[model samples]
Target: MKARFPDRAKLRAQVWNAMDNNPGTRMPAFGKYQALSEAEIDAIVDYLYTL
Candidate 1:
């Protein structure tokens, strides 16, 4: 399963971009997360690995 996302940096960027820009019609934009720092985003990515 972990092989699905081998690049942490790319995954982080995807997460950031998704939040920065609306991904699609159904997924709401998480623009509010723009206030979060890079470290915070990294933490979020790290936490995601646990799931």
Candidate 2:
């Protein structure tokens, strides 16, 4: 719920894959979460699910 529109499960997966640098995943490898720690990514992903 950090943004005006909350991220859906699909969107969350996109972000997750990008962070994991998995080009074969659902979304493209945007690498947005590359700079974040694994713990931070987990926390954010968990929050997104709650939204």
TM-score of each model, in listed order:
0.58, 0.40
RMSD of each: 3.6, 6.9
What does candidate 2's lDDT look like per residue over 1-51, in tens digits? 546336455555555465444656665443364656556666777777676
- For each candidate in the order shown, give its overall lDDT on alpha carbons: 0.62, 0.57
Give the lowest summed-lDDT range of ten residues in model 2.
4-13
Candidate 2: which stretches are off by over 4 Å? Answer: 1-13, 16-33
lDDT score for residue 28 of model 2: 46
- Give the TM-score (vs. native) of candidate 2: 0.40
Per-residue alpha-carbon lDDT of candidate 1 for residues 1-51, written as tens digits (9 for 90 to 100): 147668776667656666433446453323335656777778888987777
Total backbone collisions, model 1: 0
